[model samples]
Target: MDVSFLGGPHPQRGVGVVAPFDFALDRELWRWVPAEVSLHLTRTPFVPVEVSLDLARLVSEHETLGDAVRALNAVAPEVVAYACTSGSFVGGVAGEKAMREAMTRAGALPSLTTSGALLDALTELGARRIALVTPYTVSVTQSLEEYLAEAGITVTDRAFMGLTRHIWKVPYRDVADMARRAARGHADALFIS
Candidate 1:
């Protein structure tokens, strides 16, 4: 990307990823996606703002997320991704759309959330049966499974990585292997945390 476009870049192309804490994308996504835009990281700290799987619960609590969204919009990111997949889907398409609408209405900016992107990606990939691997407890992870199922795709199998899912410099290949092991089943593809 042109350096001038992204907040007067230092080295990498500047893309602002405005999200709540714990909203990290898998390396696999970047492997296939466009690389012209790089991300500038900013977020609500985890200690202050907990990640909520329930979309309504999330929205109800964090009314400031709208202001956060507007602040990110002011940064003029090439793509402003909301970055919470399960929470958005827990609200369903309408919920995701409503979140985007609130952001745009507050700032007149276009945005995409992980939940919308997942469904879109699934549609693009033509996946029917899928394996779900999340970094949530069983109850929340099952909510995600149900969320996906409500979208018409079946969750053939599932595994949770507990509430705190992290990698202390573990290699991507190792993570992939763990994901594969965790979600071993006769299914289409797997969603790894």
Candidate 2:
């Protein structure tokens, strides 16, 4: 397995990076996903929602998926990840499917979304009942909860901050606080994903 990093030109942007608020905690686990000959990353931090021209609003979807595809194709990466959770889930299945097709059409590369990875990990862990925590608005959080439940996992508890932008502004203290709540009782697992 191989991995390469891409982001801004400055030292703060590229490899050995630590996002202020990474929806995907400890991306180090993806050590096995990269390859020597096929690695392409772009200087675009994974933001779940973007300015959607069609919708004329900042929706929880990947409007820059096209940019992602371009970056992948330009570098010819065999495997790539969009690296946003709520955005991918916000897109729901359809939006994700669109991303796959978009990547295919642009460079014929395979793409992965954080949401998809979460579902896979959840299944592997046999997590039937789980708790969800995020800094999204009530509407977005509710939608995410509904989506997870539809995936055959039961969300016993949920917490949201009703936040829209500056997702990194969410304090770690709050996340830790929620972790405590999510782990209080016995549920299959607590999904910080």
TM-score of each: 0.73, 0.67
Q: Which candidate is the best by lDDT?
A: 1
Q: What lDDT would each prediction earn against the true structure?
A: 0.62, 0.58
Per-residue alpha-carbon lDDT of model 1 for 11-74, expressed as tens digits? 5444545455555554544565555656555564454333445432454223545666667665
Highest-TM-score candidate:
1
Candidate 2 segments whose C-alpha is farther than 4 A from its true place: 1-40, 43-63
lDDT of 2 by residue, 1-193 (tens): 2233664333221111111123334334347533323233453444454322212113223445655566556544555665556656666666656655654565555666667778888999999888888777777676667668668878888776666565665668998897777676668888775
Question: How many pairs of residues collide in each model?
Answer: 2, 2
Candidate 1 pairs with clashing backbones:
15-38, 15-40
